[model samples]
Target: MFRARSRTGATFLALAALVVSACSSGSSTSSASSPAAQAAELAALPEATPSALAPYYGQKLRWRSCGVPGFECTTLRAPLDYARTDAGDVRLAVARKKATGPGKRLGSLLVNPGGPGGSAIGYLQSYAGIGYPAQVRARYDMVAVDPRGVARSEPVECLDGRKMDAYTLTDVTPDDQREVDGLVDAYKGFAEGCGADAPELLRHVSTVDAARDMDILRAALGDRKLTYVGASYGTFLGATYAGLYPKRVGRLVLDGAMDPTLPARRLNLEQTAGFETAFKAFAKDCVRQAGCPLGGRGTRPEQAGRNLKAFFDKLDAKPLPTGDADGRRLTESLAATGVIAAMYDEAAWQQLREALTAAMKKNDGAGLLVLSDGYYEREADGRYSNLMYANAAVNCLDLPPAFGTPEDVRKSLPTFEKASPVFGEALAWAALNCAYWPVAATGEPHRIEARGAAPIVVVGTTRDPATPYRWAQSLSRQLSSGRLLTYDGDGHTAYGRGSECIDRTINTYLVRGTPPTDGKRCS
Candidate 1:
């Protein structure tokens, strides 16, 4: 998922997470940190940094004024492969906005808006740098680092614009063997493209590596310990940091947290259900509104779901025409993506409704196409960003594939369908993309018990589609010092999404080292 950039401060992470538990350290059994696991978890955390990475830890940064006013940017070199630092190097992009403070300066507060591939520098320059609370900014520098293989960092490339356009439309809800073969081919072609365009980098962008980079950034910034905020996939990054360098963790806030303990199929299935939860919320509100095209007054949510599913089925059979000069039609893949994209935040519900109205009622598919393009970051000139590519890349490499073969997917269909009948098929098939990844996975499902870490605040949205709320609960439980702050509302993340309760609690923790009361609920 791309950053919900429209809302300032939402430089929080967005994107589906790997479902399986991992023993890879960063995403290792990290969904929840239970109190019962505290003693055992502390005993289990990785015993501190290895000797091979000392050079990276000792490296320094050279900062300078960046493109954004009031912010500075710099490049730092890290080993492309930590296992072999003498082999090659990777340049990480960093940005920071110094606090305009009356309060005494604390330290650098590193923020990562999670895409796993999200541009942390871009987020800092555009949102978090200026958008965070004034007090926090006054007391601490807001820093962002585009993890290696993302944005200004040595980004990983997979497909050309045209090739990707075809790739995106490849059907996920394959109905027959031929469609399944085509889907398999699509996955193969994408994997091949990445291998061709970024052979060296593809194998190196795992979350564990990124967490190590964060420690390097912390040392470079002169911070004794890391103080940070991360959302969505960023949560996993933060959790991993604590796992690897538990002693180095400072005040950390994980918003829209991900539970890495579940496998990809389980993650996808739960996300489908989470989206249904958000949809029901939207549907309930939709029925009470005027001009609600999905339904009339008091129309049941089940009926609304059926109507939307019917629309998707119609698009599968005969895509509706869009106003694109390229004569592109709204395929079922695009339409389904557009629908699920809105499930990230309630802010997009209005736009989604309008798009749905045009496509389903008026047979004009342009609005829905716009939503899909925005999600994919497609430009007017037809180019695409590397978001989806890296999303697949990192996810595939972080853990084993969700389904090894179509037969495995076929076997799992009933369970996925049972998870979210409407979207089970697409989500299940989407999980297959990583099955054909060129690289072998480096991690496995396992729990993260950052045993010696300080208090880390974990936030969750009740109906977050990408990172389910239960993930926050699970992660908070698993962490040795996790404090679960529940946002009893919708949206991908809680902080900066119009909740004074959530913001104040997080701000207090960040500024005062005072973790919120565990199990605190914010509306």
Candidate 2:
């Protein structure tokens, strides 16, 4: 089943190495000020801080040097449930690198590489802390907070590694009632495991709760307003923050945006179409390569997709050995995930072609397995990171299940197939995963109109596989002060993916407080 997690650049970079191998593989505010000024500032906040939340808002963060050079780590306490303030605290892990400035500082800039489950602190330490444009780093303290139920925070645990391995192998494209029953059982078991693991925290990890935690982080940092950059699922988180605290938005960039207005089904369908778009692009390019597996030169993209689908069918009937120590083989489910993982970034396309060649032409399945493992954040030791677990926790809580039963999925198959003939059935089945969620959804699809927020720049890659370009367009239009920045390109995100126009436009906005002209196009 498709996890639908937005890939972070760091994850992409790590995956790139595995493809070669396999193939192979924010900022802050100040403290000392007049009481009247503080009171005025507090009053000016987009939403008034409730007295019950005062302790969280007023708490001091004692930043200590983390093992990573130039970065400091701390923890912020947020209420387990915002509505029930008396509930015990959840400690969120945070990290930051102080701005190295010759120019005036622009407060704290918080960054989240969207996973819904992606560890913001991990992103900070590994990539954003040093990989962002040098000038942006020079003028703003780079900061991140692992959202509730994500890594380094109070992480949610579900199955052990062995069960997780089996879960990942479960067939998503069921052909018989027995197979469908097995898939449904897998979903039920995963949900039950999570419920059994973290009964209390499960209900509290919604996107709304994460956004509230961000506000508390802002307050602790002493920033009058928040300056931020968010990617993938992060764009949704950022928009949620803006919707809740429009007056507090400083400068915000949402790259690879998701439309908060779409329900889970629509979102999944669009995302399936998105993957098709990206795959077509990959197919078009693959055909031009010397040893393209799907097709030789002059082959149509549709034919190429059919060829790949046929290969998946072959694997479905008889899985291929992957040379994995765990004795896992390349099943259709694993093979599809490996391919979907590469769709996140075009830089990995060549590796994908190589991987496909190795699997389809040769008998080796190791390369594709590496891609799938990377996508799932599976370590060499057979242990899994909390990425998938938390991905489910946040997504399931954010919206009601896309399909409430296997029959609901069966009914939607035609539309999904039309959206993507090759990936459709699997993605449709993937949507059923949340149907058995232990907790009812706390959020619903709605437009986010951050009416009084400062201009929020929304960047869309025309061919982003996980989050479609139209999602960015929809989100940009929904926000009252939104500016749409178009990157005519491929990949999951636009900025930092090698478009100078995109990077320069976003960097100028972040460093100088001026957004691109509304509807600006960059390549």
Candidate 3:
């Protein structure tokens, strides 16, 4: 979710300029000219129809013994095409831990921790599948399924590990046309690498397509309705499912919801500002600590921002060597990326300070590189995971490209800079990578009216670096049944990170079907 930097409204607004270009050639054909009318039309989408689910629901589930006690593994076969049920089959990897207590089971509770690329099965087995409250676990079967084009579901691949090392380190903000060409080439190379490696699966791995797959999983699990918890991009996935299958939405929690109506560029730009907000929170806290890298005696976050930018400027000219076996050198862009990555979870803020101190005081960059590698999901054997590659593919498919050219990016730099003066330039350029994608996007910005659904909780953190708080607000307003749950703290997603209030509220909801009160606040 941290790596999917394009979802913020700032980037969407920046990309809005390109959206204008793409839309200029395309016609709306509809008579609804005003936003009000368009919204009403969207609100009128028909509720999902209930079809008798196939009897082979549990048959496809090849249940196997899992590493964790009382857990079972299964492979679900779904048609690659929903429109044609007889088409070629695509396999979904699913895991579940059955109810352990004496209470009768409520139903299967599906979980997606988000990424669009985040491995839900991994997250389930590692965190949500096991760590959820015992009461919730006793009444519901904890289940997770990796989305299509994601891990263990016919994953997407791009450049090799070495090539990816170079790609992530490339300077996004170019000073000259030659440098701009280099950046464009980098974008092209990344796109081509994906095209070369996963051409067949790329087009089918979209959010809408994945939502359909979720419906299949819903039926295969023998649940009459879909009960789900989705975070970050996962919220978008859940909302998309609700939009497509409102009648099937039983109990839903969309934490850190992404506003589906915003275009790509605005999404990226808003996320840039979101990171700035999170950094400000970190900076304010950093000043209270001793040995603060930016300043110790009542310095503001803006001052810290100034100092960090200056430090990055110096690294652009002279990168720090990590002295690792991979020979991975830390450049300014990569270092900034690392900093933004840590800003997602406030728990890592202390480590960010240590990383900054090492780079500024001792010229070591190992700490920062570790953060970067974690964001990239790089493995110890020097092999890179396809997280970023799949992130871009699904993101590009979810909405139109943010920009059409680098010039469009150049035009939006000032706006991005104004939004986040510290990380603006790099983020502005990162938003442009989609402009050169090999395939045209199939989705457009539109509000999802999940009317008739049960009260769905929408969680937001005031200083969330990935999905901004405003997005949660927008999404809450858009959903007829959305209940806004506020976590007035820091992190990517609020629930289960470390908030007892949040955990209890969501757990109670999952176990007893009692949604939290609307507009509830948690520390």
Candidate 4:
């Protein structure tokens, strides 16, 4: 089953790590600097040398009109490896819808809806480029550039569609030695596949490198400074950019901020707990409705959690038939994945109910399999998206593996299980995939400290699943001039997802530079 990263404000904030005592531990009491001091610090850094940047600058782009009306398409050339600029070039697909209407134009407004793997050009074409408030679109060109190692930017693909289908169905929550070995072999095969298919590119797709690429895109677009709205993992990208070029930041909004200071293990564990929190909320709501699967059967949510575990155990004993011609089957891993997928958008809850009801009652697993396929980005023809492959490549490179071995995972299991008694074991096992990664992490945990930036709006949902809400609080505290906007609700991102308050608040900031006051709450 494909793991769809949680999208609620709280989940995205969880990426920032909980702002608890453990995460907020002691740092050197370096004298706190004023905003002006921070700006000066940013100014003091050595300028990027033209000689060092020549390869990125020298490459030409072929601009042309595109699929969307009034939008243009172009491909910018960047070093395949930023450190080895002269080695080669990579093509980055870029798109822009020029500003329209009756106001003086602002510079380009870059938008990336966080996947570390999401297609930025697609995000622009589908949502931000066209659906952003007309007022903001009129004053700023809605721009999107596909980050390296992502869609339209020479994506990293591992397994073909058919192989991936088999892989995703493998049970992550093993019930015996054989299932466990299958899971391990699956991880090894996936890592080996990525190494063979895209060796050079895989090694160079770090977030730092991606941030540098954004700078060049900024320069090439004729924007002296960058204006951006980055959600989910996009928050990490924006934070890294601000760290690298603080003085160049202009009107940045990092919704669903990722805490840069946690190691992979902590991040994954917290996220597991977050999913549990979201699940409980869903369960509570489910009880009030008729035909509720987990509730309304004289079963409390905790008992419901137990029942779900039992169902997984049964599936592990004998994988159920999915009724597909390929003879695909539903295993514990796929079931967990389907459950996780529904967490992304609460709108999918009804679908989740129908899927779960079918699986729990009939042993027919097609519904759950379909949900898993969507999250995995499986094509009807059996071609798989590079999303999961790129997701692991980027994630593995961004930070160190959560565990060193299966034993280390075993040692950490209790803590993870405590965090999310329901989903902990499965997520903990999933997090272990990186333990066998082929490459070492290129970056480490550290504060981004985007000090010289203008008022940057950081939004966090109170109960976000992927990025926990505390992450938003931590990021807001870390940024020199961050204004916190709270979405007291569920789902992945709050903006443009049917929240008028969130949409207007963000739109107001984007168009007028009037950031919502810190601690403002929107339902």
* Backbone collision tally, model 3: 19
Query: In candidate 1, what are the lDDT values of residues 69-174, reduced to their tens digit?
Result: 7988888778888888887989898888888889889999999877756677877877888888888998999999888787788888988888878887787888
Q: Rate residue 128 of model 3 by lDDT.
A: 75
**Local distance difference test values of all predictions, in order:** 0.76, 0.81, 0.74, 0.72
Candidate 4 to truth, TM: 0.90
Which residue runs does candidate 2 get wrong by more than 4 Å?
A: 1-46
Ranking by lDDT: 2, 1, 3, 4
lDDT of 2: 0.81
Single out the weakest 10-residue window by summed lDDT for candidate 4.
Answer: 12-21
lDDT of 3 by residue, 229-300 (tens): 887777888888888777788989888778776655666667778778988988998889998888886998
The Cα RMSD of model 1 versus the native structure comes to 4.0
lDDT of 2 by residue, 1-523 (tens): 1232346311221211111100000000111322112211111234677899899999999999889889999999999988898989999999999999879988899999887778888888888889999999999999999999989999999989999899888988999999999988988998999999899999999888898899999999999999999988888889889988999999999988877766566666777788899999999999998889998999999999999999999999999998999999999888888898888888999888888999999968999999989888899999998887787788778767677778887988888888888888887777777778898877766678888789999999898887789888878987889999999988888888888999999999999988999999988
Q: What is the lDDT of residue 27 in candidate 2?
A: 8
Q: State each candidate's clash count.
A: 32, 19, 19, 19
Candidate 4 Cα misplacement greater than 4 A, ranges: 1-45, 58-61, 68-70
Most accurate candidate by lDDT? 2
